[model samples]
Target: MTLDFSVVTDVWQSLVYGTLGTLFLAVAGMIIATIIGVLGVAILRTHMVIPSFLVTAFVEVIRNTPFLVQIYFIFFALPLAGVRLNPTMTAVLALGLNGGAYAIEIIRGGVESIPKGQTEAGLALGLHNHEVFRMIVLKPALRAIYPSLSSQFILLTLTTAICTSISAYELTSVGQRIEAETFRSFETYFTLTGIYLVISMVTMWTLAAIGRRAFNYPQR
Candidate 1:
């Protein structure tokens, strides 16, 4: 059957609003994840015993599980534990925690990739553990794994589509609503695909720029 572009066009405003929701949720979750990931990695790297093991276990469980199941756990399972969250908050927390787990591994790899000599050199220079990590190690680590981190964030954005199943009214969720109302599934989804593509591309580009500037890689 032929597609009706007009139906999709008519729904553009609603889709834009929904896309904004998707972007907001993704960006907010990513910010939280970044904080958690960095702190989690720091804890693993520095702590001597129990905290490190617990963080590692948490990371492993989050990384190994299916994200859909995690979301469901946050939304449905939590209510069973006498904790209730709105769908949006549930989606944000679940996505953030899941992404943070993956990011911890990515960032820890960067941290570990640093030369042993670098740490020794920092120590010899009278730099303490925190200073060594903060100054001598952190920038190089970020520069080393920034590309990987960016890819993960892009993947996280795409995964926001899954949030619709929880009735979060994200871009995909709104597009599904429009499709049901207009009976123009092809047009609705195709337009949605384009919007997602643009958003992902823009987000990647902006993040890459920030990464480069913040890390200040060597110029050719």
Candidate 2:
């Protein structure tokens, strides 16, 4: 049997919007994830019993759950509590919370890898503790975790496809509509897979560029 990508090709404009939507969800989610990751690590380091325990609990819960169930809960279950978020917002929130959990641990590992001497050196340099953390610790720690963080973010981007289940406007959702209308299941999903592969590559390239710019310190 021959393939017919023409079904997908007939609606290129919808595909563009779908791809844009995916990027929007991924970018917004990554922003939230980074914020949560950084904040979670900071709170955990403070070792305040209550805050630390809450952060730990969040990490454990999110890390252990299925992402599909999490998204469904945010979209379907929260409305019962008067927390009504549209599908788009719910999808972004789900993706962010999911990625943030992993980010917390990834960043913590990087922070722990820094030698204590570096902190001592920063302190001796007449810098405030906060300044030392920002200037000396944060950058190096980010450099150490850059690879892992980038990979996680890439996975997060791919996860946006699952948002289709919630009717969030993403690449896979668009493909589903096309498939339903065209009755081209094989062609629709095959092209969807190709599009997703492109997205993954683009995301990987963008992350690599960011890492280079942010951590391009001279190697000793």
Candidate 3:
């Protein structure tokens, strides 16, 4: 059988829409994950034992479980408890929680790497604890872990493909529909693979640029 590239032309619009949906999911997820990561780190750093323990448990549970199971729980199990979310919202929430769990550890490692003197110095300089954390600790720690964070985010974007499992209308789901309608599974999936690759590369470059601008510091 001869391979035909013409099939893609017929479904290009669907593919574009699918790609945009994927980007929306990933961007929304990352924003939520970043907030969770910051809060989780703060909770863990506090002297309050219960909150720390709760955050730790959350991190452990999310990081250890399969992402697919987590998403399934959010999308299917929640509605049974009187909480209903659309597919896109469910996907974003699941991805955020999963990525946030990992981010907690990443950010914690970065924070821990800082010297004790820095925190003390910030405190001595009339900065409140929260102020010190935000101005001194969080920014520097994020810089230290920016690469790891960015890579994690890229992984999160790739994981958006899993949203297709819940009929989230992402790239893979669109590809599947096109494949069924066009009877071109090979061509459809092959094109999808390339599209995903391009997304990943573009995401990485964009993150690198953000890092340079946000964390611009003179290297010693």
Candidate 2: C-alpha RMSD after superposition: 1.2
- Model 3: per-residue Cα lDDT over 1-220, one tens digit each: 8999789877799889999999999999999999999999998889699999999999999988999999999989999999999999999999999999999999999998888898999999999999988988888899999999999999999999999889997999999888888898889999999999999999999999999999888643
- Model 2: what TM-score? 0.96
Best by lDDT: 3
Ranking by TM-score: 3, 2, 1
Residue-by-residue lDDT tens digits, candidate 1, 1-220: 8867998787678888998999988998899889988899889877769999989999989988999999999899989999999989988998899889989999999999988899889999999988898877776887889899999999999999999989997999999898888888888888999999999999999998898679775732
Q: Which candidate leads in TM-score?
A: 3
lDDT against the true structure, per candidate, is 0.89, 0.92, 0.93
For model 2, residues 138-216, the per-residue Cα lDDT tens digits are 7789899999999999999999999999999999999989999999999988888888899999999999999999888
State the displacement of the C-alpha of residue 57, model 2, in Å, after optimal TM-score superposition: 0.3
Clashing residue pairs found in predicted model 2 = none
| Candidate 1: regions farther than 4 A off | 217-220
User: How do the candidates rank by lDDT, highest first?
Assistant: 3, 2, 1
Worst 10 residues of 2 by lDDT: 129-138
